[model samples]
Target: MLIVGAGLTGLCTAVRLARAGLVPTVIDARRAGSGTTGHSSAKVSLLQGSMLQRLARHASTETVAAYIAANRSGQEWLLDLLRERDVPFDTRLAMTYAVTESGAKDVEAERQASRDAGLEIIDVGQGDLPFPVLDAIGLPDQAQIDPVATVRALVAELESFGGRVIEGIRMTGSSFTRPWMVSTTAGEVRAEHLVLATQAPVLDRSLDFARIKAYRSYVLAYPVADLLNVPQSMSLSLDDPTRSLRTASTGEGDFLLVGGNGHEVGHGGSTQARVDEIHAWASSHLPVDEPAWSWSAQDYHLTTQVPHIGAVPGTAERLFVATGYDKWGMALASAAGELISGDILGSAPAYAEALRAKGIRTADITETAAQGASVGGRLVGDRVRLAAPGSGQTPPGEGAGRVEGNPVRPTAVSTVDGRTCALSAVCTHLGGVVAWNDAERSWDCPLHGSRFAPDGTLIEGPATSDLEPVTE
Candidate 1:
């Protein structure tokens, strides 16, 4: 069997399959744990902010309960593995808070939904946070860990079970015929079954990209002088431009992690400004000063509010896909492993059945339509803007990029660290115009979240190929 991607989902699924006596081969375009999993806050909890409440709007009570149960099982399995591998993790309370009256109502709805879903959550209004809050609720004993370390432990386990992982090799294309043939940057390989655990499945044939929306959130880590006053809990706010706070202990030092300033990828104007807002909030609210580290992660959300983790639609049973964690993937990634591996091993769980059993809700259809309209508008609008006279003539200054060329052929030009590179601006996946991310210095696709380095190398998202080099 072949698994594409080596992040949390791919590695976890590989470990499970290997433990079950299947030697799966996993491949990634980059190093293992260097993608979203490496950048995640890594909170393993069922009290996922206001997610339960959001799910309730699009699903039945039982479906939400099953979602929580699946995550619980996933959490238990992960903690067990960590203990067995001697990986260190901290047990902390996971919480959701609201600062505004409207946010408080949402929190109340979340509280009710969480309680109905069998969580022993408690009211911790205006919790022990350093800053004041209007209301809050928490679930104790939820855990947090260094996601990269956890990924390393999983890799060790997979290797011990004889499963192989190859890095820096990207899957370029695939043929779904019997003995499925997958073409990678390195070479072609054949497998009896295939699993795509990437952020979004790279293939456009399945139209899986249209089924979910892509978003990016920023995170900043600041050094704290007094650790005693730190939140010491995983907390998320329900207010606009949501704020997420947690404490992290690392070999370098202990730091307070402040996250959340999420927006649809590519569309979020001035990515650097998003980072600055988090910095401003952290400096003002917490007992922190200069930021020690800052980064961002991309996530996919479904209108159904449940991840799609089964056979790739239209790919028959030979291919499978797992995505749409909606930024609460620490436990959901493990759940995906269990569900997908169980399906392959013929012992899929009941929760997996429930996730797949739910019929499409009208809310889901409406949201999907809205997202489609937005995407269509972006594609057409971007093309028209790029086609205008004097659109891409002037060279961008240092640490900047612009889309050049006309409607028929667009070029992405950027100068970073004294080197200027020009490449195709059109995304390799579904032909979306790429936008420059000021913070990360990469070209980001507004259509499906595909990103590329300054040199046009594919970074992540559904794109399988790198941008073609353009002669200026």
Candidate 2:
């Protein structure tokens, strides 16, 4: 067996399959867990900040119940593995709070949905939040984890089971014949079963990417002087420009992680402004110094509000896929791993069966079509704009980038840290025009979330290759 990603979903699935007497080879385009899994907030909780309420809008009560069941099983499985491996994680209350009246209504709806899903959520009207809130809800004994540590433990477990892990291997193509062949940058490898546990499946055969929309968000960690005063709960805000708070202990000292201000991958302008917004909020509310570290993360979400985990639509049960966690990947990834492995080993738990039983709804299809139309609009509009550009050679100012040239071929130019680079502005995934992300100093695709470094190195998303270098 072969897995095409080495994040939590891929590694967990690989480890489980290995324990069941199958040696799976897990490969990653980058280092293991260096993608979304590493950059995640790593809050494992059932009270997922208005998620249940949003899901109830498009799904039946039974489907929501099954979804919660699957997530519960996933959480238990992860906690057990962490305990067995001696990985240290903190148990804290996971709270969802709202400051505005509209947000309060959403939280009330979420509270009702939580009850319907059988979660023991408590209504904490105005909790220990620094600011005033209209409403607050929490589930006690939820978990917060160091994502990097969790990945390391999983890697060790997989290796102990005689599973091989290879990094820096990009999957170029695949042939789903008997003994399926996967073409990577390293070489072609054949396996009977293949699992795509990537954030977004690289393959487009099943149109899974079409069913989901990609979003990018930022996280900033600040060194805190008064850890005692900091909220002990892993908390999220149910309002626009969402605010997520959780404390962390690192080698340097304790810190507060503030995350949110999310937008579509490349549509939102001035990514730096989003970071500024976070900084402004932290400065106003938290007793923290300058940010010690900051980074951006990308995730995909289905309108149906449930992750898709099963055989690819037409792969004859040979190709498995798991994606669309909707920013709550910590436990869902584990659940996805178990479900996919169970499908292969024929011992999938009852929750896995329940999740599979949940079918797609018409609302989901309509949303998917709407997202597709938006992507189409971006492609046509961006191409037309790029076609009306000026000279392609002039270098951009430091820390800036621009797309220049004619309609037939556009060149992306960026200068960062006193260096400059030029590459094709076209995304390798589906020819979407790449836009510069001022915050991360990278080119991002507006179509399917593919992102690239300043020199055009493929960072993540469904793109299979780096942006081509532009010749004079």
lDDT of 2 by residue, 78-163 (tens): 88889999998999989999888888888899989898888899988777787888999999999999899999999999999999
- TM-score against truth, every candidate: 0.97, 0.97
Estimate the lDDT of model 2: 0.88
Q: How many backbone clashes does candidate 1 have?
A: 0
Cα displacement (angstroms), candidate 1, residue 285, comes to 0.4
Model 1 residue runs over 4 Å out of place are: 314-316, 387-392
Residue 76 of model 1, lDDT score? 92
- Give one digit per residue, the lDDT tens place, for model 1 in 209-276: 77778899999998876667788889999988899988888888888899999999999679999999
TM-score of 2: 0.97
In every candidate, how many clashes are there? 0, 0
